[model samples]
Target chain A: MPRKAADEIVIALAGQPNCGKSTLFNAVAGFKVDVGNFAGTSVAFAETRVTFHGRKIRLIDLPGTYSISSHDLAEKVARDFLLSGEVDALINVVDASMLSRSLEFSVQLTEMRVPMVMCLNMMDEAQRKGMEIDTSRLEELLGIPVRTAVAVVGTGIDEVFRQAIRVAGGVVPAVEPRYDNDIEQALSRLLAVYPQALKDALPLSERFVALRLLEKDEDFERKVGASSPDFLARASEERHRLAEREGRAETLALGSHRHGLVLDLYEKVVRHRRGNVLGTREKVDRFIIHPIGGAITVVGSLLITFFLAFFLGNAIAGLVDVPFGALRASIQAMPKGMGPAVLIGLFEGVVAGAGIVLPYLVPLLVLLAIFEDTGLLPRIAFMVDGILHRVGLHGSSVVPLILGFGCNVPSIMATRTLENPRDRFVTMMVAPFVTCSARSVVIIALAGKYLGVLATVALYLFGGLMSMAVSYSLTRSKKRKSLGVIMEVPPLRQPYPRIVVRKVWLRLREFVLVAWPVLIVSSLALSLLSYAGADATINGLLSPLTTSVLQLPAAVGIPLFLGLFRKELTLIMLGAALGTDAIGNVLSNGQILVLVVFTMLYVPCVATLAAQWREGGFKTAAASALLNLGVSIAVAGAVARFVGAA
Target chain B: MEGETAAIHALHSDGATRKRIQSLGLFEGRRICVVARAPFSGPLLVEDVATGARVMIARDLAENIEMESRAPEGR
Candidate 1:
């Protein structure tokens, strides 16, 4: 939130997707940068400060974009930031092995006339594949200082920044890219007649303006429109006539022309051993994404991750449970009638806040972040793209739903990885149907106790089917067909430990700050209601829904109600009301199945509702609650009737 | 063309899809390869041979990305 000082030099790190831009930012700026991979990870630039060459520079980690085309959100961010004129210089990070492709972007930066430097990152990987890039030759051709780096291991970073500081100080002049003679002649003509933009378009000029118009970039046209309505028209006419003269579209001719120049430059400097370049990545991807192998790996990896979070989260949660249990007992025993309701409320709040949720939520979020950081998740998304398309969601929805098995909160948060709003909403709503561990405690307890094993298995399978149906129905629209799923598959790397820990700590802090307050306060209120002897009144209120509709006895209402605050509480209170853990003492087998089904499908916990309210707004939260209520009640009532008849 | 290296002949995609692909360094004259396709009618994995940037195109969109094979029948 702190503003950069006026004198600090602002340097933007721009690159194609997964080009180690962020990896380099962390190496230089010291690991505080907010990290995300693939496209549009950071919608706007994430700024960090580092002292380089005796000057503290404000480094902006721009989103990964292939070019400054205004098609996607991330590209728009990169494009607008480059033209913003706030940047003192640019450091274009090019993946070293992918030199010719990355150079196409480098050529644009040079043409924009921004003082620039090129960071040829991933030099080690380039070498492993037998690519020998002549950095000196590249520097000679591009007119910008070039530095080589293996950013993940932090090599050549200091030299990159040292040269960046020197460039920002105006030691380097902006370089212009060469184009085809026909387009070149048209560019010169356009530049001659160009009406300058009215605003202070520093770092952009008549030449860059003319080229942008030639590229037929619509966003640039709109910006330039206020001053020159006829300017683009004249430029378009030139481009059109030129295209007619050449036997191709003007843009393609110019693109290939610019690309030809880049290819020629790199051709002089780089040597490659072809056919041998498809190395470990291709090998690993072959087995892992192979339909049979992919299915096993995906299923196997997810099962292991869940078992780890579940067992580990539960074990760590024990440390919280004991102290909070003692604290609650002491608070409950406080002097008679001294606002016992308040005291009970206070005690319940502490237990739910510390003892119940955090145990599972912390480990789950950390593990999910690890999957995200390692770039393993998008591959899972890629494999599942076909199945998920049937549900009106993208492949990325798989990551959040898998995380939803641990807890719905972070899984909902994980949907931010999904770019579309409707996708996020539908994913968020269906995510709760994954049978989170909390609800698992209640379902396993009740269903396992009364109906034995098979019905419980059937119950879980039911939840999965409902999740797909719900998400599909909520998000399907023919008009808003997804723009196709184009995910960047980052090379598998060791997860950065610092970033992983920091993400866990940051998101856990949200649970502590936002969700726990709602949780604790509601826990207190629920406990206070029982203490105030309002149990009978509550049972009466729920009678229509419970006995008449769900066909469960009135005694089940309080546990079902308290389950909203903490799902495990349903079992605890049920044991207390029934006078034993043997739930079959009061309920028939059929009645038990209906009750557990309703519990599993009913509204998400109060804390989860609070999260929905925060992330999706009041309308979304209300809609989800209504959806859960209607589905569970109707299903439970029909099943209860079928069971009674049987 | 299934396993061969090819040059993008011409893109038949609409505006949004075309511009989006262009941002991923896909355009006319770029060389590409069809790496593999999932069995039972899955997405086709295509890579820009020059960049090593891979994209998985659904069967429907593959029709729009017309290509002329560049590599010979056998390696």
Candidate 2:
């Protein structure tokens, strides 16, 4: 195969929070990226190469932001990138049904004068809603090539690429909307002071920069730098004069003017009607949002998820046990030696770590991805918004809460969406209590086998209730003002099978990469400890806590240490410590419940700790771990006493 | 003879109006009604459309907002 030359074309896929921007990027780039309905899911830029017409085009998928006004970090990144004029073309992906709001962004992009293409995505949904937008009129009004696309189904994808390539190749004309006369006059004055190189490099004309300066966009001023401060000062003064003459601030005036144009464009091209579908959607929303119905749905979903995890975990555990049983039998049949003991230990460790825990974790993550992709999660957030507000956290924090079900590392990372630092910290500190899949595995394996299904459910509920209580306490300690919840609920769409499968696979791969090495090393270390006399001493020391409080054998201590690296390893090591069938027999139901509860609320895994360190420094990570440890111990002690008494 | 004039507390309409309102939390059962219309046909400040809450939005955007009238004069 001939090597294709890299035709570097920076194409930005921009849209609202859940309008399938990431999904489209995955379809085009053939890579797995986070896709969720709630805001701030994509914080960083993801780049990939796609071959279009035998040319490699580098596509940059930026975080979904509401506007280019630099109100937030995601918006700042999008605005700066567009202003930098480094990109060959901008591909604005709009949700077709929500054209009115989506078009506002396209119009804003047009003012920047970047060679752009409009991809009208979700065409199927638009048609279903009886929306008929005149594409040609829209194209003419925006002065950009428009391509209809159903990105999930891969429709009109080729045309999207073609238009993008054409725009990059300078075949498409840029649309520079005319501003008011006063603004134009100020822009001309500012333009004369700009260096020729700077003028040539910027995507928009000096007029745009002047307008931004008038609006006091810090980023715009920074981009212009010290060289044009005098000019910027004059521009700012002129803008004030213009605003004074118009009897309004320049920024508000400019906003209304742009909004005026947006309204005109929507009036001209977009049409809608009273429809039954809208009514149906509303009725459904009522059911989903009602206090009783919503709570029931949430609990039901969680119950189903647990059952699925249990079923899958048991199957994988059964398969793993067969090989282990065979190996143990064969080893006993062989001559007595250290080799047989070591082999048995190694085989037992691998099966316990990989086979039992991974299957459960992987499926739960898949179900989570599906729930998120299908757009039902945000409704759940809306339902809980009232309670979350009372707790001093915004409803948007629900994304992190839902993600906590899959893994706390990503859940902690999702806290970046919270605008208030205090809120973010509180959310991060409490998020690990959401019963992550790793803990779920431990609960299912231990509580289910020994205690019962009801006990396992109770354990999970305890973890959740504990997390909320901690969050509530943390928020109260700060005595902060209530943060408002502003979230976009993307219309529920069926999750694309391809995207969901790829996301699940990618998440599972990440887990294996991060946890597998740690699991193997921990197993080997534990085996060595057992081989020496150290295991006996360690067990003896842990016996007081395990027996008096937890009421479990001393051997369970080794697994608790392993839980720090990987939660499921605790169950595996526990299984190995107390044989497969005899596990429930040896450890009483109360002991098992305590063990499960402790493991669930225990310190986060090593991967999560590293993520914490990266997200919030070393001090924060240490604080989080130590806090969790104290809570877990206290909770376990209490649970142990209660269960023992019962 | 006319019995009495009820103070309008909700504004309801359909089509593009409903969509504009729906997006802004001005939907059925949402408390809002047009409080005042601007002289220059600018934005309107409406009491809640769904919850009878209050918000101010551009009239151009407001035209798309839909609301229903409160029960006439307390039935």
Q: Specify the highest-TM-score model's number.
A: 2
Number of the top candidate by DockQ?
A: 1
For residues A415-488, write the lDDT of model 2, one tens digit per residue: 88777777777777877788888888878877877778787777777777787787787777675564444445
DockQ, cand. 2: 0.05
lDDT of 1: 0.73
RMSD of each: 4.8, 7.3
Evaluated at residue A646, the lDDT of candidate 2 is: 92
Estimate, for each residue in A323-379, the C-alpha lDDT of model 1 and write its tens digit. 766765676567856387667656655565565556666666677678777777766
List the TM values for chain B, per candidate: 0.80, 0.44
